[model samples]
Structure formats: structure tokens, C-alpha cells
Target chain A: MTDKKEVFGMRFGQTAGGCAAAVLVAAMLAACTSSSTSSQSSSTSAPAGSNGTVIKIGVELPLSGGDAANGIPTNNGVLLAVEEANKAGVPGGFTFADDSLDDAVQGAHDPAQGAQNTKNFISDSAVLAMVGPFNSNVAKAEIPLTNDAELAEISPSNTNPGLTLGDDAKKLRTSHPDIDSYFRVCTTDDKQGAAGAQFARKLGFKKVFIVDDNETYGKGLADVFDAAFRKAGGSVLGHEHLTKNQQDFKALLTKAHSLGPDFIYYGGTTVTGGGLLRKQMADAGMGSIPYVGGDGISDDTFLKQAGSMANNSYYTVAAPEASKLASAKGFIAAYKAKFKSDVGPYSANAYTAAKIEIAAILKALQADGNKLPTRAEVRKNVAATKNFVSPIGNVGFDANGDTTAPILSIYKISGGKAQFVDQINLKT
Target chain B: MDIFLQQLVNGLSLGGIYALIALGYTMVYGIIELINFAHGDIYTLGTFVSLAVLLGLGVSGEVHGFTLVWVVLLTIVTAMLLCGIVGVLIERLAYRRLRNAPRLAPLITAIGVSFILENAMQLWRGPTPIAFPAVIPNPSLQFGGVEIAAKQILVVVLAFVMMAGLQLFIYRTKMGKAMRATAQDRDAAQLMGININTTIALTFLIGSALAGAAGFISGVYYQSTWFFNGFEAGLKAFTAAVLGGIGNVAGAMLGGFVIGLVEAFATQFIPQGAQWTNVVVFSVLVLVLVFRPSGLLGEALPEKV
Candidate 1:
């Protein structure tokens, strides 16, 4: 009787302890997740003007964790544009300020976080125009919210064509399908993919194998590459869509090796197994095969992550080489001086996007008789933007909100740096 | 057949690292019913320490034969020691307080420690994935149609050697006997003159040391690691531990290899296999648990304190 009673007491005590710990852990996990996702308490870098009127450019990007490699530099570019606009001074005695939000959760860009960030930006009254939500998937989530709120969002890096063209884009903005609120400064994946396919053939690669990171951006880019490469008379051995955050691709690479492709095409960023994939490809004895990707892998991070295997790899950026362009010289120097980091692949494109937004906001204010314009009025002005000279070249939007000044730049990795090779004029 | 052979090599190489991590989880659970959620981060911490040490020693871009062997051994040892100390501190500070508390308390505490370690690493190393320079030169070894990597062989051989050495230590060493006694029944072992605290701390020491080695090996193998790498890698190791019978030592080693082989084979043969790798891995886990609730090597038992 005594032994059984003690046993019961011990078990009961253990159960009670377990229950208490469970609640504490549950509460902590909840707190941790919420704090990580909510980067909405962003600081404004804009100075208060003499008129005490501050107009804000809401910035949303994957500004933390692994995506920071691309997103931070992009954010810096946007911030730089706002600083310049503040110095130049708008017509309405309004100071242009930036209110940024991070859509990154844990270490990568997340769509749900992007949606929440969009809501936060929409709730802010001072924000008339927004300058990001970089990834294509994040843009897809954010567009509906911005559209419903009549807030203008201009992405610097989104390349998926479905975000701007066809029935697919119409589905994203159900609130105002006729009045497009989403615009991107970069060219579409179709142009990039076609350019890559033709380039691969020119380099004498007859057989190609394709892989994607299995995200909206990656899959879309790979699909375009597949169709274009096939039409160019290059045999596509196989195309595989890798699971998100799936680290190991040795087996996939091994399988691709047997198919005996001369080239491997990856449609993903450095953060999404892009660098590791090429390194493992070398381990599978296919390291010498030229690897091609869209702008996602064109960043310097890709070169570092791909290591010694980075050589012979080629990628296409859907924007001009901002560093090489004479018009972009001042922006690049300013970006470097401010961020203490070299201009990333999409930094100039983001700068151009921000500049366009500021220009439209000033234009809207001018049309409003030097009064602060409504989100709708500012959005309309942004949509009406045509042949606005900027760092990345003449910026304009078509009816569908795709950049009219579409240009694709090709680059090859040499000495662990991306060397500009050729430019394909993507504008029809 | 060639694909199969190649994947076999890939699986074995990957499995060796998982087994090392799983051993830490299993040993901690065996000694104390606490899950040690931070075990995975301990592995990650190991990798960072190894990287720091390597960089400090000016080792980068593949060291030659003798220098390579010496530096790898030195770096792994330093990582293991640092990780072992951290494991001990974690137990002494966190798990020790909750040992007699409800089982859920320590389990939750383990998770808290996991976050703390991950966040701390993030703060130290920033958010982006840092590339570890290749320490081993890539060379292909031909076996008919199958080609194997020298690095793969090193990972497997080193893992097995450590596991074997651990086995000897457990069965032969007197401290090992004390640890076994403590694991069997804490109260009974206390009455039998076994120092329960020391034994438990020692268990954490060995387990975390092995995990640290795993971290070093994985970092060297993968060539890139982020602060969050440990979380996913930890889950996989935890799965291996559970698959092999959580408290069983030899079981973790076997389970690790099995999971690796399954993932590799599924990726090679399954249509859209890369997408289905986790589904297949978890499916096998569910199926195995349904048939054998105690896992493959686990003896049937009710809840224990």
C-alpha cells in the first residue's frame, strides 16, 4: 500500500511539472514568433521640414536574416532616394521620409509576414507611396492589401511576369483590377529566360538540366527557361522543383549528371540552396558545367557562397549595371558612403524605383495645389509616370505596370566577381 | 544502379552527421528524462567554434595532407570541449532546477535554451549564411560506375570511430557504469553510492561533445551554415533519435544511416522526389511508430521520471 501510494505521488508530481512547463514554453514561443515577425517599428530617416509637413515612402523588404544580403542593400537604396528627395525638397513644403518594414521571418522572406507588413503600412496615414516587398511571392501577398487600400507599391526586384501580366495578375488585385497599383522596375522572367537560353546556345551548350527553389520566383523563372531553351533547339534533359529550404541536392545533381547535360540552370537566389547546389554539383563531377540563373543568383553573395565552383557560372540581372552606368555613378558612391557596403545587384534598381515614387508623390502634391495628396491620387500619378529619367535609365510603366525600359544584363563570374558580359535589350 | 550507388554514398555521408547529433539527444534522455532541445544548437555552436578556430589558425582553402589532418583534429577537439562545457552549464543552470519538476518543465526549458542559443548565434554572426571555405580538396574515387568522394569517406569513418570509442567508454569505464546506474533508477542509484549529478553532467558532456564534432563535420561538409541551420538539422537528428529508440545508443547510429538512405533513395526514385523527401521521411516515422511504439530498439515502457 505504501509503495503504490509513493509511486502514484511521483507520477502525479511529474505530470504537474510537465503541465506547468508546457504553458511557459507555449507562451514564450508565441512571444518570440510575434517579435521576430513584427519589424514594423521602423525609424524614419527624413528630417522635419520648415513647413513641418512630412510625407512618407513606406518601405517593405525582407530586411533581416539570410535575405538581408539582398534586402538590406535594397532597403538602403530606397532610404538613399528618400534622403535625396528630402534634400531636393518637394513642391508642397513636404519632407520625404521612409518608413520601412521587414517581411523576413527567421532567416528568409515570408509571404504571410509580408501581408502583415502591408497591413501595417496601409494603417499608417503618412505613407502615400511604398517602395518594396522584394520577392515575387511576397509581392503576390502584399498586392491585394495595397490595392484594396489604394496604396502604391513599386517592387525593385520582382521578375515573375504573372505579377503584372494576364489573368494571374488580375486575380491578385480583385479590389481594383482595372486600376493597377503594383509596378516593378525590373524586367520580366520571360525576357531573362529567353536571353539565358540564347546565351547558353551561343556558348555551345547543347543539353541543359533545370532546377528551381520551388518558390513563386524560382519556379516561374525555371518554367520560362525550359520553354525558351527548348524552342532554341537546346535539349532540356530534365527539370526538378526542389522543396523549400531543402538543403541536400546531391541525389538530384547525381541524377542530372546521368542525363549528361552540359549546362545546369538554377532559378533561385543564393539563400535558397543556389550556391550549395553548384558546390555539390562539383562534388558530383558536374562542377565544370556552366550554371545559369536569373537575377536571383546574380548577387555577390552567390559568388561567395558558390566558393571555388563560382567560376564559369553565368547569370542575368533584369536591370542595367548600375555601377557601370554614368548616370548611376553618384547614387553608387552615395550608397557606398551611407551603407558602408558595396551596391548589391538590385540596389540601383531599387533606387530608381524609390526615385520614381518620390517623383510621383511630388507630382501628385503639385496637382493637389500644394496639398498632401490622397493615396489614390499619388497611386494614379505613379501609374502615369512616363519616361522619367533616373539612375537605371528612363523609367515608365505600361498599362499593366511592367517597366517599359526593360533591359537584361548578362554577367559571368571571374575571380570571384561578377563581370559584365553583354546586355540584351528586352524592350520590344 | 549507378544512381543507387551514388545516392548510397550521399546518404551515408549525410547519415553520419545525423547519427552524431542523435547520440547527444539519446544520451541526455537516457540519463535524465529531459529532451535537451538545445542539443542541436550545441552542434551548430560546435561548427562556429571550429570555424573560428580554423580561421584563427589561418587555415582556409584546403590544407595539405599532414596539416589538414592535424588542424581538423585540433579544431574538432576544441569545438567538442567548448560544446561539452556549454552542455554542462545548461544542465547545471536550467535542467538541474527542473529535474524533479514536471517532465514538461525541463522539456520546455530545453526549447527555451534552443532559442537562446540560436538567437545568441544570430546576434554574434549576423543573419546571413556565412560560407565556410572548403577544407578538403574534392577528388572522385571510382568504383565501377559509382564515384565516391574522399570527404564522404572521412565523415563516415570519423563518425564510426567516435561511436565505437563511445561504446567502449560506456561499457568499460567505471564512470560509464555509474552513468548507467544513474540512468536506470535515480533514487536506487543514489542509495547505491552513485553520484547522480556528476553522472548526468558527464552524460551531457559526452553527448554534446559528439554533437560538437558533428557540427564541425557538417559545417566542413556543407560548406555553408547559417544561425538557423541547427534548427532544421536538430529536428532531423531528433527524428533519428526517436526513430532509433531515444535512449538507445547503437539504435541512434543505425537510425541515422536508415533516415539518410531513405531520404537519398526517395530523392533519386520518387517522382518530384526532392519535394517529397520530408513527406517520405515523416511517413516512414509514423509507420514505424504505429508498428513499434517504443521504436526499433526501444523496450516497451510507460512514463518515467
Candidate 2:
């Protein structure tokens, strides 16, 4: 009788064990999020000279893990600018030194670590300015810290608009809302989405349907595209947000097909069903419709996943062709010589940002009567930087701290590769 | 009306794949009474296996005529055999030792095995989606705003044929009787002439082979797959197995079609239907569990104790 009770208890335990199998899937997903490639804080010492006082320029970037490729080159560009500034010499007998911190926690950028990096950069009294934070989410966390410290911060690649625009941005700098301490050399997503809408109108598309990956970046981009596209005299058929990892889009596409939209716009990255959405469009008879997307989908993965159906799909990248820009020739040569690698996508932008920071520091030093000036003086000069000529077109920041010249490059996929199409410069 | 018909076609095709996968879960559970969490990854492994065979044969784009027929059949067979052997090995290595242990022991080990298979595939094939060639020319016939592809019809037909064959194999063969006897009472079957080890291994072999067929079918239909696809597919198949009655093969098939139809109809009827499809399907699951714990077609067998 006791043996029978034990077997029954085991059967009940077996049923509980079945539920644990599902729990185990969730636990394994968390376990797979591993950390690797440690980040190091390396400082470059300026060569000593007559009456050379070492002034520091601090930087924060995701320098290890998966973001290493994106962060290392941008950091190198900043270092290159400091190296040049020191060799050329600064006013007040100042020799520039670099104090860089890595914000990556695990192969990916962590916002908390970025905020901590901002605090560390602020504590260094000799640190004149800050550059970095490759991702937008990281910037949101770091900006408030820099703003409170009256430290000048600049980003080379963050394209999200909420960082520098609107009353929401004003809330970040409550200490001095009127005086913005943050700036970015890259074009914003607002301009990119508008550019997509303008391009759609230029293509003579009368009606379009929009889809987003239901993520912050994708949804924001699509929202702007939806509004701007409607304002551009084009009819929006419908907008739908896709659940992440949802594979089959046949039913959704069939509904879209019935509406008879001439174009489809997907505001998402390759991993978030952008490529698969395009591929499966063929299954539902909407394969012939021209597909448009933002920089999220402008990846090699998109080209590879879409296969033969890749043709006629267009995507917009909110950056100039920096590598191909004639003005970037000198910077490109210096980058290759220094790093023994090709200038990455945003290397020129990083160079321009660093150069602009150096120029601002010199201006502040000249104003401070050749004396060591406060970070506030540097912040003022950087904010007052009007339309100045640099590598990535005109290098100047507007009141909201966006690039004065916002450019969007368009590319089309054909022959299983993305080919460069055109670049549109938004008149802001 | 045409839309209804179109969605029905889509439901049946997608449901067929689910049924194949559910049969695997149900068969393994019927014999050993373990959920076999690694079964989903076996399907994933089968996909990569077929992909390798096709690519090795210098296949790209679309192959036509007799070459297409042989290439697909050969790849599908290879995936099934390899995945079946893998299932058998997993039993012999990981689950066999834990068989006599507590129920939680083998269940956790199955989860561990599932993680290894997923990571192994990710390591070998890279983490991104690999493009499968469109060897199965998907030309749909359209009538009155309703579209149905030849591939969809083929998937449904092939799934039914495999399910029917599995049904016969489980009922008519000498091995089938041994499996049934062992499932009923392992000690009693051992007292007789039934080899319990062989019966359980056969269950895994047959179940895993069906999952392999499902992998091949989805690979050809979707034309692209990733290492992570197994998790999503496995979760849904697990839900279907529970909904049908975990230990019954026919119940799993019936439950699969129900889930598939529910998914398709939700997408068609609901606003932003794609967003709400998963919610509706899982809601059906929650309702079933609350009202009828034994599932739709499951028998309320009396506890021996």
C-alpha cells in the first residue's frame, strides 16, 4: 500500500516535471546571454614640451564584446584627433591627453555602465570635454549626468531624435534647460523618416502600407514615416506592428494585398523579420510591390535572407557616404595609416566630432586669457559652433544639437547585393 | 467566402507540420512518459542536415525536372535517418541512466540536452538565418481573390500520409504490441517476452523521424531557417501535444489542426490579427486546461494506486 502511494506521488511529480521543461527553456535563454572580451581603459600621454601642461579629453564608448568593431574604430578616430592636436600644439601651452572609458558590460552596450562612465569622466578635473556613446539608449542614460556636470558631450553615430529634441529632451537637462550640453554629428531619425517619405513620393507611389518590429527604434521610425508619408500627399493603407520572432506573414500580407497598396515599408532590422517579411511577400502576390525600409534593414543579412526576391527593395541610411566623400580623403588616409584598417562606416563622422571638440577647446582657452578654463567654457564654445566646414559635409550643430547638414543615402538590392543608389541632403 | 477558404488552406498546411512534430512528443511520452524537451531541437538539427545535403549536391536557386525530385527525396531521407539515430543516441546516453531515477531527473536532463543541440547547431551553422534554395517552385493558383500554392497542397498531403503510416505502424506491427504492453505496465511487459528497452528506443526512432520529415517540409516551404527557430516551433508543438492529450497519437494530430485553424482564423478575424494570433491560440490552451485537464481526446484512466 505504501509503494502504491509512492508511485502515485511520482506520477504527480512527473506532471510537474513537464511544466519545468517550459521553465527550463526560459532559463536557458537567460543563460545564453554570455559576456566576453573585456574592455580596457587606455590613455594616450602627450609628448612633453616646453611648459606643456597635460589637459585631458575624456571619451566613453562600447569598446568590447559584440560592439567592439563599431566602438574601437570610432574611439581610434577620437584618439587620432587628439594626437594631431597635440603635435600641432594647443594655446596656453596645453598638451592634450586622452582619458577613455568603456561602457560595454557584456559584449553589448549597457546604459547603466554608460551612466557610470559619464560620472568617471566628469570627476577628472583636467578633462575638458567628452565624446562617445555609440548607441542611443546609452546616450539617454549618460546625457543627464554630463548635462548636470556642464560637460560637453558628442556622439558620432546615435541617430535617435528624442536625445536632442522636444520637451522630453528638455526634461533631461533641468539644471540648465536653455543651455544644451549634448550634440551629435550624425543625422537624426526624424530627418531619415521624412527623407523616406519624400523618396516614396518621388517614386510616384500613391498608396503604401507600413509595418514595424514593435521595438523602440523600429516603431519610432515607422511612426515618423507614417505621419510624414501622409503629409507628403500619399495615402497610408494601414500600419501594423509585428510581434518579435513571428515567422509567417502570409495572412497579414494577404490582407495587405487585398487593399492594393503599391508599396510596402518595413521599419525594422534584418533579425526582426525585415528580410523574411520581404521574402514571404512573394508568397502572397505582393512580391512585385517595391519595399522600402530604414537603416535598420540596411544590412547584408537582409540581402542574404531575401535571396532572389531582394530586388526592388530600397533602404535609407542616415549618414553620408563618408568613405566616398571627397572631403574625407585626408582623414581616410590618416585612419588607414594609423590603424592599418579601412575607415569604418562612421569613422569620418567620429573624426569630425573630435576635431570640432578640439577646435572648441582652443577657442575656450583663447577666451579664458590663455589660462586653464572650466568645462563650462568648453561647452559654450561647442554649442556656439555654427556652420563650419569639415570632412562629412558642413560640420556644424544646430540649437537642438543635430548636424546642420542631414544626409540620407539610399541603396537598392539587386543580384543578391545592395548597390548604392542616391544621397538626399535634407534642407533643415 | 474566398478569404475563408484561403485561410483554411493556410491553416491545414501549417497544421500538418505541427501534427508531425506533436506525434514525436506524444509517441515518446506514451512510451517513457517523459516530455522529451530535446525533440524540438532534433527537428532543428534535421533542418541543417537537409540543408547540408542539398548544398553539397551543388544546389542553388531552383532545380527542375527529375533532378529536383531526387534531390529533395534524398535530402529528406538523409535528415530522417540522421535525426532518428540522434534521438536513439540521446536516449542511450542521457536519458537511459536517468530512467529509473525521479521524474524530474530525466526532464531536466532533456532540457540540458536541448540546450546542447541548439548551441551545437548555432556554432556549426553560424547564428544568422541560412537561405534554403527554392527548389520547390511555389506557383499558386488564384481564383476569386483566393490563392493556394502547390507546395501547400503537397505539405498537407505528405503530412497526412506520414501520420496515417505512423498510425498503422503503431497498431499492426509486432513491435507495436510490445510498445503498447510496455506503456500499459513496464513490469508486467518485462515478465512477458517484451523487450522494454527496444520498445522505448523504437518509439524515439519513429517519433524523431517524423520530426525530421517536418523539418524538411518547413525548410522547403519557408525557404529560409535559423538555429533559433526550433525553440518557437517546439513551444507551439508542445502546446498542441498538451491540448490533444499528451500520450495519445491521434489526439496530438487532432490538437495540432485545432491550434492551426485557431491561429489562421484569429489572424483573419481580429484587427491586427497577426499581433493577436498567439494570444488567442494560447487562450484556447488555458481554457482547455481549466475545463478538461486530460485534454480534448485524452482518456481519464483510473490511477492504479
Candidate 3:
């Protein structure tokens, strides 16, 4: 019995040892595969300094879901910018390459997805630079990921004041003061609001009623505009806050009518503010009141839904009119030829973002003659740039990565089209 | 006063549609003693069906002198018929087997079915709301410098017509009497040679059909709808039905209009977030329920013999 027990114990020990060995081998193989994959991609691709070396850039934009109506066109614009950069050729010897991904998953603008997308971009060894995450919410989610990964992120449309300036500006100036990986081409809501106030004054509106959708973006823009309007010698009739998925603005309109404000300033996107307001005001016999709004209302979808009742409303957008830019005509024509659709609100911004990305990669490659710079080095180089001349004029960032340029305009709804009035230069 | 009058007209019209839909809940609850959670989705289905009919016929937004109106009416009838069939089918598929089970079982089944219908709608029609073509002309009548749309009058009249016709059907018609008899005593009706199951099926069909018309009118009036509109509208109507006395048919209609007017009034004076409007409305509901648990017109059914 003792001999038999000894043999059984030995058998059991051998089996256990074999199982452990197999697990160890499996883990090793996984690590090996991951390393091999990265090394393989890195080695197979041409070196940044080599002739014909394709400089891989990451383009992140909402391509399918709620924001797709705006995002897809912006993506097309990035492609045009990349193609132009490739044609222009890097100062050394490099051409632009793009790896685009759809960030239009449900809650795409949520911070979780932003972090996940940033991680995914960073994991791709070829992608040295990234662009996008249109909404400020997305930017908030992504800033940390990009900061840690050291990959540069240039957002074309994130305008929330707090995203750049941490949660509270008083606590610490910006979200990541020491980190220079993040950049934004679009002017902040502060500038847009001031421009809207100026436009309201120019139109001879002495008293303006302000309404916000009570979201971060809407409330922020409303506060900024209210202050500016007051400074511009405008009387505030009333201020109202509304939530999402709300219909029936008759009561608010009635009160505003009683107040007898000459103009209405709605600081919210088209989904929450556009159709209901237009329809309600028209139904209330105030169709020609000349409402003013920010970039959130610049979408054609707003006009389409609001229909003819949306006529005479005004909106403030971040960039100049793409139609009038003589230099942008070629870019626009190329974009349409490629995408088979009109460029959306953020298209020019995305194009500029892509240019910024290419410029950073080229700078990084020049600094390191043999291999491409790490995401961190590229990010640092991107932040160091003092001036860049792209589609939207010179691209330069202040301490907050906000554009140094002061270009905001008021566009009127004429026959269901956004007709440009005059640019409101705040610097003046 | 003029603005109030105009808003009153809008509120009444909006309430009329709600009342029409509320009747469906009231009638279904009257017979089954279970809230038909899926009723709103059925209404949404009706709207989509009508939209499909209009689109299939290539009807444009241009109203060519009642031609579009006739087409829209046809579409509405078709939608109601389709919804009636669906209501009967759902009864057979989901509710029939659970007839003898606990009441909670059927209620849970109805909620599950509601989710399925909503998700299916999201799949069939993309998340974006399709703009329903405006069949009614934008009419503005200036009385004392206040403008009111004729569409408002049309909707309110349509609701009353549906309610009166339904009331007559229940009280005056043989099938209606059969439904009331089944509600009174199912076993006795079954013993008297009236098929209880058939009467229940008919109740669902009629209720769903009325709801279909309500949904169609809402779409036409608002000129837009999302797949999720049914959920919100459904919740509001459920509240309305409860407010009027769940089992009472006329009470449901009264409750719907009251809720609509209250909502319109709340939006006008309450400067709070429009989202808070629901809180205010539901708060009133709680207060009313505290005061009257059996509801405004509800009478307790006689104890079992």
C-alpha cells in the first residue's frame, strides 16, 4: 500500500507540473506575439527620414452616429488635407499617410470612449499624431490618455472653456498645464459669444433675451454672451434654462414677448433649440424676430428641420466662409471630388488639424534622423511650433492651445441658407 | 389674453390627441385589469405604417387641394387596421398563455414586448426622426392680434369624434354590450354563451385602432416623430388614464386634456429646465393620488360573491 501511494503521488505531481508549464508557455506566446506584431509593423514601414516614407497620422472623428452628419464631412476634409500634404512633400523626404477610425459608437463623446480611442491610437506604432474628438466632452475624456501616451491630439472643434482649463480655472489654469500634447484649432466659446453679442448690437437689438439648454456647452456660451451683451450696452430682458428632450416653448416665448425683447439669443445645438423654437416662434407670430445663436446652430440640419420658419435667424461660427477663401477653393473642390458631398461645419478645422499633425511628424523626424520620435517627443515638438500657415490662416496656440487668431462671423438664414454677414474681429 | 387664448387652443388640440390615446389604455385596462405597457409602441407602429403608406405612394409635401388629405386619411385607416391586427396578434402571442398566471406576469411581459417594439423601430428606422410631411396648411387667424392654427381645431374635433363614436359603440352596439358584460363578469358571460376570449380580443383591437388614429394625428400635427416618441407619450397617457380613473372610459379622455393643459401652462410660467416639467407634473399626480387613490371617477368593483 505504501509503494502504491508513493507512485500515485508522483503521478499527480507530474500532471500538475505539466499544466503549469503549458500555462507558462501560453503567456509567453501572447507576449511574444504582441511584441513581434509591434516590431514587425515598425520595421516593415519605411523610416521617417527615408525617401517615400509614409508618415502615418491618426484621424479620429465621429463617422457614423449622431455626430456623423458633421463628422463625416470633417473627415473628408482631413483626407483632402493629407493628400495635399503628401503632394507638397515634407521638408525632408516624407509623404503623409492616414489611419482613420469611426468614433461614432454610442456615447462616442463620452470620456470612456475618448480614453479608449486614444489608447487604441497610441497602440498603433505607425500613428505618430492624431486629430479630432469634435465635442468638448470627448476632449475631456481624451486629454489624459493623450498626455500619458505622449501622442499629440489636435481637436478641430472642442470649444468648451473648461476642457482646456481643467474642471475649475481657478484651481489650476488648464486641464494639463505641463502637458503640451493637446491642441485646438477652433476658437473658444468665449470668442464666439462675444462675436454673437457684437452681431446682436450691430443689428440694433437693445434688449436681448438669453436662453440656454442647461448643458455644459450651452450654459457656458450663454454666460459668455450675456456678459458681452451687457458690456455692449444691451439690456437683458430675461434668462431661461431648459433641459434636453423638451418640447413646448410657448410659455417661454409668451414671457419673452411680454418683456418685448428685440432679439432672442439661444445658446444650444440644433437638436435641442432649432425646430421647436422656430416652429413655436412662428406659431406665436414672431417668425421675423431675428434670433442669434452660436456654432451649435450652424448645422444645415437645423435649417432643414426648422423649415421656412427658420428664416432671418442668425448664427455665429468659428471659421471664415469657406466659399470666399480663394486658397480654399482648390481644397474644397478636391474634397467634394473625393467625398461627393458638401463640406460640413468643422471640415476646414479638421483639414487644419491634419496639417498640424503632418508638421509635427516632420519636425520629429528631422530632429531624430534615423527613427521617428516617440509620441511624447512628437507631441512636444507640435506644442513648440510658433506659427503654422494652413487653410484657416496661421495656426498658432496660446498657453491654452486656443487659436491666436480672432475670426468669428455672423451668418443669416436667407431662403434656408446660411448667408454670411460680416466677420466680428474681437481683437479690434 | 390673446396669447393665452392661442396657447389654450394649442393645448386643447394636443390634449385631444392624448385623450384619444388615453382611451386605449383605459379600455384595455378595463377588460384585462392590466396596464398595456405596449400600447404606446403600438401607436408608434401606427405612425410608422402611415408614414410608410405615404412614402410608398410617393406623396409629396405639396397639398394639392385635398388630394393629399384623402391620401393621408387612407393611410390613417390602413395604419389603424394594421394596428388592430397587431393588437389581436400580440394578445394571442404574449398575453393569452398568461391569462391564468399572476397579473404581474402579464405586466412584465408587456414591458418586455414594449422594449422589443422600440428597439425594432430603431433598427427599422434609423435613430434620426423622419419629418412627417405637413398635410395641413399653416393657417393663422388673427383674432385680437392673436394667431391660432386651424390644425388645432381639427385635432380637437377628431378626438371628440373618436371618443363619442367609441362611447356609442360600447353602450349602444351588441359587441360593445358584450365587452361590458365580460368586464362585469367573465365566468357568467362565458356561461351565457359569450366567448370571453373573443370579447377581450375585440377590446384590444378597438383600443389599438383608436390609438393608431391618435398617433397619426400627432405625427401630422407635430410634423416629426422619433422611434422613442411612443415611450414618452405612452408614459404621459398612462398618467392621464390613472388620473381619470383607470377603468373609466370617459375619465381617461378628461384626464388626458387636463394633463396636456397643465403641461402647456407649466412650460409657460415655469422658467426651470423643461426636464423639470415632468417632475412638476408627476408631483401633482402624487398629490392627487394621495387625495384620491381610486381616482377622480373610479368606483370600486363589487366584492366577489
lDDT leader: 1
Residue A395, candidate 3: alpha-carbon lDDT: 70
1 or 2, greater by DockQ: 1
Per-residue lDDT for A108-201 in model 2, tens only? 6778998998888887788878888777777778788888899999888877677898976887886787888899988876676788898989
Which candidate, 2 or 3, has the higher DockQ? 2
Off by over 4 Å in 1: A1-177, A181-184, A188-191, A322-396, B136-138, B299-305
lDDT against the true structure, per candidate, is: 0.79, 0.79, 0.72
Cα-lDDT of candidate 3: 0.72
Per-residue alpha-carbon lDDT of candidate 1 for residues A31-134, written as tens digits (9 for 90 to 100): 34433423443553546455248888888887767455556666767878887887776775678877788887997678899899889888888888898877
- In the order shown, the chain A TM-scores of the predictions are 0.72, 0.85, 0.75
How would you order the candidates by TM-score, starting with the best?
2, 3, 1
DockQ of 1: 0.46
Query: What is the docking quality class of candidate 3?
Result: acceptable
Deviation (Å) of B85 in candidate 1: 0.4
DockQ for candidate 3, please give it.
Answer: 0.28
In model 3, how well does chain A match by TM-score?
Answer: 0.75
For model 2, name the residue pairs that clash. Answer: A65-A107
Worst lDDT run of 10 residues, candidate 3 chain A, spans A8-17
DockQ, candidate 2, comes to: 0.41
